[model samples]
Target chain A: MMQRRPMIGLALMAVASCIAVAARLLVVRTLDGSLVVGWPGPTLGQFRVDAVLVACSAGAALGASGAILQTLLRNPLASPFVLGVTSGAGAGVAFASLAASIAGMAAPTGAALGAPALAGALLALGCVLLLSRRHGALDPITLILGGVIVGAIASAGSTVAEALLPPERRGLLTGWLFGRIPEVPDMGSLAACAAAALGLTGLGAAWGNRLDGAALSDDEARSIGIALGPMRTAMFIGCGVATAATVALCGPIAFVGLLAPHCARALVGARNRILVPAAAVAGAGLLTAADALRQWIDIGGGRLPLGAVTAVFGGVAFLVLLRRTAAGWMA
Target chain B: MSALRFQSPIIARGAFMFAPGEVAPSAGRVTVLIGPNGGGKTTALRAAAGMLAPEQGAILLDGAPVHTMPAAQRAARMALVAQRPEVGAPFSVRDVVALGRVLRPASPERIAHALARSGLTQLADRPFHALSGGQQQRVAVARAFAQHEPGGVLLLDEAFAAVDPPEAAALVREIRAEAAAGATVLAATHDLSVASALADDVWCIAGGRSTAFGAARELLTRAALPSLLGVAVAEAHGSRGTIAVADYGGILPEAPR
Candidate 1:
């Protein structure tokens, strides 16, 4: 029974992914009402493809980052957004835009924004670690509280940056801040996000066995040949880079990182090598499906924020998971 | 057997410090560290297992300082089974056991054999957290056994405390077999009878000090046991084995001049 779980999960993820792609394709129809497959006039078909790719890549990045953070923190509740990485990235991009305007330069776009965002994410990660650490250890409660505090501070900084921006750019910035996926005008940006997601996820999978050992006590993990400090540092950095890149591309899409890994754990057992990739696939499916749902919902003229859509479902899942695993946490 | 020479002063900040001591487990033999509660048994075992780096002094395995060595290299030379083993998530018994083989090459046959020896073959597919405490301890033993390298050091801290007698005996048999096959085995336990029966050499610790270290038959005497444990000890020799029983309620007698 235990062995078959991962196989079933893989099959389900594959089916869900197929459905997500099919759903996105179906959303883009030609003038005659047929589903647009090849080229549809100017940019309609291409636009949907781009949206799907960005969603898939961003979701993959968030899921892998969450898996790594959960292992490093030894807390199942850990995720990129919970750890303040997303807000930090948002603040970083806002600061960059403000700097560009002050220098009388056009606002930076596409992949050029990922570098600063990554720096901010890493800084936030470091601050959370520093604040929560007590005698070289991190308790789950302290870590979570530290993350929330840092996230709030970063969010405030981002809001101030938005206020400083020119009136014309303010609306677009506000929309992005609410977790709308930005249009990538260039293929380079899309490829960059995809590369960052895949590269970091691959690195995470390579460290999967050590991550499994890390899930035990520090003493036990060391006894099994894992250098705890170095392992945690590596995982933290990987998670930060992946999350920051995704946030730079698609704003701060929440809950996919928090939700996907738990779903994966239910499908696959806690063998990290299998779980990390499984979570990535599940995350992609989840984000794509959420996007589809957002399009279907008639929220006036504008679409609902992707973050809001995911949070509505992911929040309930988190509550259920917390209740079910409360005893495990206490233990 | 691997020669394990542990010389260190273990310091736990704001808690306790184990005074400097050197203990050498004899080659091709089982050595048991017997001590009271809060007496630094786990600290000593941790230092020897390379889990705790000594504030001063060093632990040498085969004449090399273990603390200075890379983690992987140190792990390849020793295996430690903690007193209270915990899994962060619900992993299968097989997956938990596989964690022990990190420093060594993959060997499914070795993992299977260890599981069978620990009487956990039937529970291989079960979630580790779903098992009873005794069963969990046995799973840890199985993992340690799977991790054993030729002429390596094995350190177990109260590993069999929660296990049933039959399973504990089987684990003891496995430890003895490993020692005979050229592995140095050091275990810590509060059970003096089990220690006496299993240990080729015994180190009696009290108040962070090694009060005695010698042949188990000689060091585990009624008088030595009482002095070490702060209780009256009675020994009964039967056809089965020599049993050293402790009377916990008795007050400590005055020291002999």
Candidate 2:
């Protein structure tokens, strides 16, 4: 009953992605009540493709990052957000805009914005890791606590930066924070995010054996010939980089990172080699599907924020998965 | 068969300081470490298993430096079963057992062989967290069995602490089988009855000291440790097969630095 299911996850991903892409391509009602439906020719197709590509890359990074984070922390509840990286990235963009206003300079966009986001994300992750070390090894409880503390502090920094922004500029940061699939995403940010997602997923799969041993106690893992320190250090860094790239591309999309792995796990079991890739595809499908859903639903207002759609739907999906697989988190 | 001999440096686990000492066990034999609680028996086994590094010197398996060996290489040569916290996730019994073969593919037949040898073949599909302590202990043994080379080293610390009499007897058979297959076994246990019957050599640790307490076959047969417990001792048996551990670390003097 517990054998590895490599192809099932792939097949499900293909089905989900194809459906999401068709939905996204076939119809779209623009914000001004102009219904653009059926066969979006070359120019429009290219735009749709770019949006889908950005969403998939960011979402894949998030899902793969979350899977590795949960394993490294040995805590089932762990996600990209738990490590404070996403919030830190938000703070970086927030403070950068605040700095730009004070300096009377135009705010950075695309790759320029991504640089600070990556820096802030990595800085926050480093602090959490540094705070959690005991005798050169990470203790799970200390790590979880450190992540929570760091995340809280980063969230506060974002709120402060947001409060200081002028009303007109504030709207841009607010819209960014609400998360969206950019129709014209900077090609460089998309490429970097995609590379990180694929790279980290491959690394996770290559180190699957060591990760499996890590599911046991520290001493036990060591006995099985796992160099716990080196493997943990490498995997943590990989996850951090992937997550940072995700934040750089998408401004803190919530729940997708946490939920996608569970969805993948439902199909792939916990063997990380297959699980990492499975989760990546699952994340891609989910975010694109969410984007497609946003286009379809109308709530007597302007287009719904991508973040709102994800948070409400993802939270509900998470609750459902949590109820079904409480055993997945057992100590 | 590998012979283990090393001078363990002064090791501190938490606030407890284990004083330095040396223990050399005969090759291809079962050597039981006997000690009072907090007397550094676990520290010794961990050091021997290369899971804990000595502050100075190395644990020599045959002539190789066990502590400095790369983890993957070390795992192919040595296996350890120590008391540990419950596994962190709901890995299947087979999944946990398959971990022992990290250096190689976890073939189903090999995993089943290890599970069957440990008397847990039927429970291979169960989640590790769902097992009783005795069954969990058996799973630990199964993991070691899966990873272990026939002529490699096996270190056990409180490995049989959770098992019932029948399971204990079954595990004893497993240990004997390992030794018979030319592996050297070092187990840290308080069960003198098990030590008495099972051990070939003995390392009696006390007051943070480890001493090579002589052959179990000779000492237990002579009933030499009758006075350690200040009680009646078992009568000598003429047969060479059965022996008792007149063994207690209390009788051994602290080793000199």
Candidate 3:
């Protein structure tokens, strides 16, 4: 039973990703193919394909980040949005947008790490809030409260920036705020995905045992010769880096960070080796599926925010799990 | 068994740390800490194991300061089993016990030895959370015994409270074995008989201070038990001490010592 769990998680992720990728390919060829109305060149067609890849990569990054956070914090509620790590990045992006508009400069023309640095700072703030409030490590209430506060500030900053920018630049500002996968392919998104993946896998392997021991108690983990302070800090930092990458690409898609870990835990169990990788794949699968649905299904004239779709699905799954657990099904 | 010389400053809200210069636990025997409820006996033990920091004292293992050292460093020298442990979820009996020994994927032989020594070998595969309170305490004690490193200090905080008298005695025997194997064992307990049978030395605490620190036999006298119960001792003998309570089951009203 112990050995079976990790395999099951890995297998489930592989299956989900394969299915999502297949659906994405079909959707790009059908619905998105019809949308290319001009005398489309091969290079133009390549843009749509590239967008799918970028979306997939972004999804993967969120998954990996969520997994790492869940294990490190040893809390099911821990994720990029819930922990306020991405709020830092979101705040950074919002600040950049507002500053560029005020200066009459082009959007996306600021320091490349401006947004990510903001994210890192927000993450640091969340850490301080959590650590200072009687509960040394991240507790559910503290993390959620911190995230809500930081998120509100970031949203307010984005709103003020949008209202101030002219209509011409306002579209760009909003796109950045809501997150858009540009048809003009940039390596930043791909690089962010790679970094998130590497961080997730590396930390997952090195700290897996210590992470598991942490679920017991700090004293118990310490008694086992695991250095609690350094290990916890490294895990949180790794989660932060992963969150920064995903936020940089996806514009702080709210509930995926909150949803992915719980889904992964439900699929497998609380074991880190399974939970970490599972969360990464599940996050990717969820985002990719949502993006694919956005391209395939015509809601209005333009695409719906993939975040909205994911929020609905994630919320439904969360409710289902809660109900099932209440009814004694999942325990 | 080598002696544990604790020196540290433990400072926390609702906790006090005895300065290293203030107290040094003598070694090579069982040192039982007896105190009133909330007299900080558990906190003191936690400080000694580096689980909690002292506000002003330095902990010494074999006369070396361990307060500034990382918790992992102190772990190599000490192990602790908490009283009334809160273990979540269901795990096999062996898995629960194996948690005490942090080294992963425990060997069947070693786990068996720990269980048999703790007298729970027959229930090795039973679900731990399903075990009776007495059985669970034995499992916890077995884990402590398995984690016992030679010359290491094993600290137990009110460990015997959850067990029956016979089971506690058996558990004490395993602790004595750890002592015989050269580990300094210090346990805090409200159970006087358990301490009397197992401890070689005693540190009796009350009102946030050490009332007595001497041979276990002397500190386990009829007089010391009453202090633990907030009364006076009236009798002492070979293996038992009788406290002359004012009321004996309401049969004898008040007895003057």
Candidate 4:
């Protein structure tokens, strides 16, 4: 019918998060204020709330963006990290760090100031190279190659910037590169939420029929009376905007974009109309659960970055999926 | 009964051309287009089915400019099955067949009826790509049978070649049944025996030109067979004025029965 399995998956996701979130709340209320990383212990209510909010929001953003990019490019490797969006963000942060030392600015302030605009510029450049006459459309292989090149350039620039830093500012850039959610006192989270909401709305408005036709061959699509040019451009822009918003909020998380859509497809089947939304919701739910678990597992003093948690899970899931779909992938 | 017609239309692909003056075939008739390899037989079938744009021709359904209409609109009146059914997904045979009815709003009863007639009702649940070549070909024909208008044109391009003799014969019976029930059928094939058995009118093709367009009984002759094949025949025979190739020098054996 209408993705009965994925709908079941959606319900499972909600249940998993509710249990994890409930445990997190209990620990927070019992403990005074400290939260550890490995063992489930008592945690402060305020910090527990912070972790839940950050993890769910971060997961939703990363997952939704990843789903969009993978579907749009018909590529399994079109993640923010693999495609160099994170690397570009890293370069922007590095640049900000350099500017801060020269003018005495804080690292978080520098990243907040520099990353979004630089990401926009680099995103445009990547799109141009991909959609060039020589290239023509953002194919999965070319997009990955372009991302690698951009990422290499950005990584090198960040390294140079790190070497120049007076030891203190360097760690900040590294942490952000590894995907740390900055404690931005609600205002910054609201901005990320707004951006993600806008992107999701756009994705919703542009439903799955057109994209399904796109999954077919160009000749086949044309034979079925689908107009080619406009459909391609719209899909590309939609994916780009969604990924950009997520990267802006969470720096850049790996493997979500590369993995989520495929997972959704397996759970929901290849029909794009159901697949796209199911992927978005699954991504959101997975990230939310991961975030809740992160908060619950507070054994040591420092908190584990939610991005690292998702990467570990996403990477394993991706490998298993790769094995399951070797034939389809080859085709 | 609705009339099927084509005007002084030229359908060409690259350097080849296939066009003849207007001819409206009566209802319940099977017209077979026969030609040598690469002689615009497939091209004409594609044009007639509205898959190809005719450079200077007009196709008319009930004497209206069907060529000028959109593909979806044209598809409503005719169903086309290409040489090789290029299905590249894990769709069940039933799902792949169902895609033919995408343009037409067919009831499940009609769909089941078509599939049963085409002899694909048994293998309906198999994954399409997993099926043998002959099975896939049968599914393609069944899909076309499910999708067209009530009394539509079924344009088939070499649809029977991939199939075995019995299966192909059965398919021919189904095509004839469709024609008898008021559908204009145009089939393209290189096998002259099938043409002789199934066709009402045989349009013979050679060197990108169509000649000898007449009843199959009139056009199929003993002498024209060897020249048409471009090989010396030891001997030839006709059954009920139906042409059948026997032997090629010392190379091939005589026709069976």
RMSD of each: 4.8, 5.5, 5.3, 6.0
Off by over 4 Å in 4: A1-177, A180-216, A220-232, A293-304, A328-331, B1-75, B78-89, B103-107, B153-161, B164-166, B179-257
lDDT by residue (A1-331, candidate 1, tens digit) is: 6558788887887688779877865664333444444445446566677778988888888888887777767778788876678778778878888898889988776566766676677678778778877546554457679889999998899899989999766654555555655445346656777887798788878888888888877778888888877777666667766777777677778788988888888777677887888888888888888887776676555667887898888889889989987766325
Report the lDDT tens digits of candidate 2 across residue range B115-149. 99888988988888788887898999999999998
Query: Who is ahead in DockQ, 1 or 4?
Result: 1
RMSD of 2: 5.5
lDDT of each: 0.78, 0.79, 0.64, 0.62
Query: What's the distance in Å from true for residue A173, model 1?
Result: 7.3
After TM-score superposition, the amount by which residue B215's alpha carbon in candidate 4 deviates from its true location, in angstroms, is 4.9
Tell me the deviation in Å of residue B232 in model 1: 1.6
Fnat for the candidates in order: 0.60, 0.62, 0.32, 0.07
lDDT: the better of candidates 1 and 4: 1
- Which regions of candidate 1 are displaced past 4 Å? A1-8, A28-42, A93-119, A129-146, A155-177, A185-189, A328-331, B8-15, B249-257
Candidate 4 residue lDDT tens string, B128-157: 667778887888888777775567887888
Give Cα distance to truth, residue B257, candidate 2, Å. 52
The candidate that wins on TM-score is 2
- Give the least accurate 10-residue stretch of model 2 chain A, judged by summed lDDT: A1-10
The complex in candidate 2 yields a DockQ of: 0.48
Count of clashes, each model: 0, 2, 18, 7
lDDT at A98 for candidate 4?
A: 84
1 versus 4: better TM-score goes to = 1
